[model samples]
Target: MKRSKKRIIKTIVFEILLIISSLLIFAPILLAIIMSIQPPEFVFSYPPKFLPRGFFVQNYIDAFKIVPFARMILNSALISIFITLGKLFTGSLSGYAYANFSFKGSKITFYVLFATLFIPAEIVLIVPLFRIISRLGWTNTYWAMTIPFLASATNTFLMQQHFKTIPKEFEDAARIDGATPMQYFTKVLLPLSRPIIAGAAIINFTYAWNMYLWPMIVAMEDRMKTVQVAINMIMNAESSNNWGIIMAATVVALLPTLILFFALQDLFVKSLVGSGVKG
Candidate 1:
């Protein structure tokens, strides 16, 4: 009975801690939502108000009117979709080759590729990458944003790990059926890789959607700017002190990634767990 009481007490404490941690993490988002709904006058009123005074939906409306929010949204969505598709295509093929084929210096090649994960592309390679893009006359085009990020070492590494975990029997069965390597890969391996693929897609989409620096550097034209870059346009066009409008734009910008994450969270979790194990 004493041990049972101790366990119950510990569980209660853990639950309380968990709830507190969750609230702390969620506080900023909750505050942002509250601020987005507040009036311009209430935004910075003395003592500050944490609750909504009224449903000021006009802030959301004003966010769109202040800039080409729709166009920027389209640009962001298309760019993110392209990057996600490209990453999946290249990552899967590269991972398949590295995981299944044994060639000269295969291990060395894979190690080199994996080493790129430690390198920060934004800081180190930005200048040279920009130079290359400029030389190609892609500085103001979608290609400038999409091509450089088409392949992700992290995604490739994850794919390779998950592929390695597949049982040899599947490979043997494919061989016995006289299936070509590509056929076997497409028909057999890919079907079983849905979880990881979904997870990787969401990750790539979120990264591309949230990218600000590269898009800002490459896209100077208003029409070419991504949503993240264009969010600043809200502040530039509106009064900088209007926190409600800024928060409204922020909430709008944050929704896509949040929705995608919530929808695919199960697949994402499965991929993380499955990718770490080897057969």
Candidate 2:
């Protein structure tokens, strides 16, 4: 009885500490959001106003006017969605095959793909990728933004680790019930793999949304550029005095990822543990 009580007390203490740490981490983000909506004078005020005063929404209006974020946001959404879905599909199939099947050169192929995680992307592929895209006439187009990153080694590694944790009996049972491999994969494994799927989607979506260097290189034209690139265009040495509009733009840019994470929060937490196990 005393041990149970001690454990409960320890758990409570841990949770309290965890909550405090989470709040501390989010403090800057919360402060930025508060500052974003405030009038310009209060932005540099001493002691700092931690709470929102009335709505000074002019910064947001000016942000849109100063930059064409509407089109950039839409482009980001479309590219991110495609990249996320493509990575999920490719990762799942490759992971499943590696975990379950044995075929000629399968081991070699898996090793090659896994090896890719180590090499710095810029050194090995950037020049060739640029040449290929230029030859394909995909520059300044959505295809240029989305296609190169469709396959991700990290996503495949996570899925492969997660799939290894499932029981072989599950596959045996499905086979005995006259189920084909594709049917078993689609109907049984994929359905139960929600945690990793959500994880991959969240991670890939955030990557695609926040991508900078490639988007800048590929989509040089204003209409084709992404939000991050657009943000850079909005802010430079000349715009140092207009920090309020920059903050407002940053806040608006953060909305989609924040909303997505909140919506899939449960799955996101599970993915952390799910990716680590191999049994």
TM-score for each candidate, following the candidate numbering: 0.94, 0.93
**Candidate 2, 140-241: lDDT as tens digits:** 999998888888888877887788888888999999999999999998899879988897888899999999989888888888988888788778635546
Q: Estimate, for each residue in 92-202, the C-alpha lDDT of model 1 and write its tens digit.
A: 999999989999999998899999999988999999999999999998899999999999889889888888899978999999999989998999999999889989999
lDDT of 2 at 80: 91
TM-score of 2: 0.93
Q: Top model by lDDT, which number?
A: 1
Best by TM-score: 1
Quantify all predictions' global Cα lDDT against the true fold.
0.90, 0.86
